[model samples]
Target: MNGPEEGRIRLTVLGGYLGSGKTTWLRHQLHEGQFARARVIVNEAAETPVDHALLGQASGLCVLAGGCVCCVAKAELISVLRKLCDERTRADAAGQRLDHIVLETSGLADPGPIVAAIKSDPVLVYHIVVSEIIVAADARHAMSQLRSEPLGRRQIEIADRIIVTKVDEAEPAELTKLLSTLVSINPAARISGAVKGVETALPSFEGVAPDALPDLNGQALKPPVAPTRLQLDDSIDWTAFTIWLSALLHARGDDIVRVKGVVRTPAGRLLLQTVRKVVQTPEILPEQDGLGEDNMIVLIGRGFTQSQLARSLRYFAGKR
Candidate 1:
């Protein structure tokens, strides 16, 4: 009644480089019957979470925001997973059932941590499984982005299935060249092609059957690796953080593909998530307990200095 009573959940991960159209493909899958009772995690390492806003309206989808479901937000992700599991158990008590979990990583996110998260969280390990890693690539930019951007390339290399987006816009020769290049980089992935408004290439989550995940026997879970935590004070000056972020973005615009975070501003706490060269306006979320304890932000890109980023935000600590 509440969650899935007795059914198979196809857990899928959709990943791609910036502007590679991962969101477009995910939107298509969410609406199709091929998917049922889906949970999504949109990871953006910036002030605003654009994807969260994009997916918020999906009727059957439940989303967890304010952190990527990877290293940075691993704790939060665990918390979310535990809560969902508890919900399932409660539903089971009431003779109800829930469906599946689908995670969509930000373009700049590393799928490794996400994989690691699913494997490591004991409570989640019992309820979820790593069904597939679907990586998306821009047909026009795959070669250069894969060769030059480690983050982008890692997304492609780790995929069980790869989807090449923007094929319709590319010249026929260009699409062929892109596919060839991607193969050279990651020969293990199963590659498919798609363009705008195309759903032919993306896989349906429904295909992930209950018996599919043999690895999740709910026996043992590995201990989690330690994670670094960043917390900001209630008096943080988000204006300063914004100014500093702008300057940092200007300096590393090429490397900084996205920035998203929840910060305390003079007016109130707001959520920010962005794409490269596109900073979304802050959105106010319902006030909750401990919202300010871990004032989190993510800086996703190459050549980024975490210390420098932390240093810049230290100004928001109200001590400078």
Candidate 2:
């Protein structure tokens, strides 16, 4: 977008294992305008999603979010970038410019495929460039999760910058142990701690060796794992889906992890959020004129699918 300064598009790729607070950090970053004027791509693994609703004003900022950007949504990722570039060109024709691009990958996702897609994709090179990978870790649970999850290790492996969140929840001893563990996982990345909400500081990607570890062994880091993606383009019956979803939540709220998305309602475009059974109707933004997409919901869990819950949302498109 902004052509005069560098003719380069700085990209910040955010990644962290599930529940590591990636969304919270992104919400802050986007609001701060740190990555201003950038096209954002948010990826989620589940059919019932979480962060989208909490993203506040930035919900309209996202270009794609269904599954991991590197896996199932790779094509859409490229399409969004191309669209961003085209928009920038139009702006240039009209005497304006844009800034960089930011990508927020699912917590459970491995940054490998997404990185490869951006670096190797021919068209992307014409417009954007990968700036850095920012990995967030929950200080309270990071050590154990790093040891137990392959996705966790992969996130650390690809990090150019590592940030520790939820420091207030961790004791001094636990924080010390976490820093020690992080050194072994990624010594090159600068480590910083965050508490509650306000940890706003200039991002640092310095001291990260380009070839920090050749042949990064994610497999040796943890047990076997599998990745997934789903795409649906069918129309959704909002009335039926909403009624069914509410009933299902009342019955098995404990089974839900996180549910979030922009839903089409008779009133207007409504933002929905569900943390287990507790559902809150978030503030609705002005109608996005001419934007046409399904009443989409992305839910993520240990064993969730379009078949079981998709029917509940069957009035909507069948799990896209």
Candidate 3:
């Protein structure tokens, strides 16, 4: 599974609970040309792999059948990804470089372990970088599923972006409640509605800095923590900000769900995001009209306190 790789491949993992329309959202993306230059891996517990069949004649489509790719078939998943990387490298000479790789997990899968595997794997980490974890939630049944299934809630908790599917069928009140619940569970995730199809632009890693990716193999790690969110109100010092975040992830990488926000730094305004333990390169954004200079960051993770975050951030602010 080795080849003459040209550059890193962006990987997007799509996950959700059973009957949450993960397949439907993927179908839309394929038809809409959103994944035009991407290789897709579909995981299904059943032997037949119905979703693969529905996505007929699409190039670079593969399926991992008989088990969830996150657990029972994790090794197989890695093999498939490596194979794609090799193929991409071979095709590079022909000017057919792979732009991205999208993995659609079974509705029952937990994306956390799948993500951890990618970040932990030495070989895969070199060629692949996770762009985002997009979770599809059924708007009509989301509340019920959230209450009954731990996986359902966990999916929302770790998502970078959440697409609420089947919105056209859900009542206004039901949709409102579902949106409220989702916000409470993961304040850092960007939530969007998908009715007939997703019209909104799906999140991507488009201008991320190259140095944002952490060195997973070299970092000293710790136990996973409980989920918590921290919102900061003041500007941050560029040097102190990097030092604090690097140290935090170095020690508690496993506990972090995601850290995302826009902050005013000495360099400029930048958009920041981290999935699992790996951070995407921060993208510099243009200043918006009528918004005064302000720095705000929302940290969502497991097992940290608001006071603890506030105190640490205050120390950094004082340095600024």
Candidate 4:
């Protein structure tokens, strides 16, 4: 979405539910130079943000956190966009002028409202054009979620393109059911598969029947998800921590939706993450000095408190 000469910055909005791999997909796209010279904005619902650490190579990067951009943080997003437009307008003609922005929204966001906000803003309507709304769907968990999570269904319906992520990890039957369900939810949106954020061909399941999802009410009906942060020291045992995580997920996978953070060890900085009960492979990040959020993990789920998380993790780390 680049109308460079007209000074209107084209915007692409990327959204997905908790742990849907939007960050992974966006990181791969950035590494592949898919959006050259485009500014990247990451919206983190949690106060302690780590997603921004993965996308370091963007032309410009900013993190918006502490609220969901589609709801509580809508005004903040608009203000940032306006600031970008002002900078671009005043930029010297001899300097490089970026004309595109990719906004990676929080997992809990609804794209329809965000889109409406952008279109209705008098100033933004002229300064920015929303080129696409791309949503990433988790192949393993979407079938069950679309049936229960109203936000998930709305995301699918509002998307211009749907990227079914973790295709290789999910069973073929489950992937098929998810794909068919996505079609039933938003046949107007183009759908494709991605394994580890790399685009891949989807297998044909022509006769497969989509899941019969119920009519979910608004987001208020579901239990609220809040982030709980756990601080770990560098000397903490990674092995013990993993064991603790496995136990926690086994007991509360339904409630523990996401776990993500950067940790330090004998090796380089490691990025740890999990979606539900599925633990993603840890990634080694390029060392950055004075990173405050390191040695901390943020768990997003319901029915848990920060003190419980702290006590559990501390005990597991042998800090009796």
Best lDDT among the predictions, by candidate number:
4
- The backbone clash count of each candidate, in order, is 20, 15, 5, 0
What do the candidate models score in CA lDDT, each in turn?
A: 0.62, 0.64, 0.71, 0.87
- Tens digits of lDDT, candidate 4, 1-320: 33442657789999999999999899999889888689999998888788988888877888998889999999999999989988887774758676799999999889888889988998888888888899999888877778777878889999999999989888988888888888988899999988878999998979999888876654346678877788887788988988899999999999999999888877778989999998988889887834338888889999989888778888888887
Clash total of candidate 1: 20
Q: What does candidate 1's lDDT look like per residue over 287-316, in tens digits? A: 653322336665566564667567767764
Residues 1-320, candidate 3, lDDT per residue (tens digit)?
Answer: 13543468989999987657777688787888888778888887544344554454346788887678888889999998888879888988999888798999976589999989988988888888888999998876677657644667889999999999877767766677677777777889998878645754323323322222223445454443222345545544667778778777777764554465566676776766564455657767665523212354545445787688778766766733
Candidate achieving the largest TM-score: 4
Instruction: Write the candidate numbers in order of decreasing TM-score.
Output: 4, 2, 1, 3
Clashing pairs in 4: none
The residue-by-residue lDDT of candidate 2 on 251-272, one tens digit each, is: 7664454455566566676766
Question: What TM-score against the true fold does each predicted structure earn?
Answer: 0.61, 0.66, 0.60, 0.93
Full-model lDDT, candidate 4: 0.87
Candidate 2 Cα outliers beyond 4 Å, as residue runs: 1-5, 200-299, 303-320
Candidates 3 and 4 compared by lDDT, better number: 4
* Cα RMSD (angstroms) for every candidate in the order listed: 10.4, 8.1, 21.7, 2.4
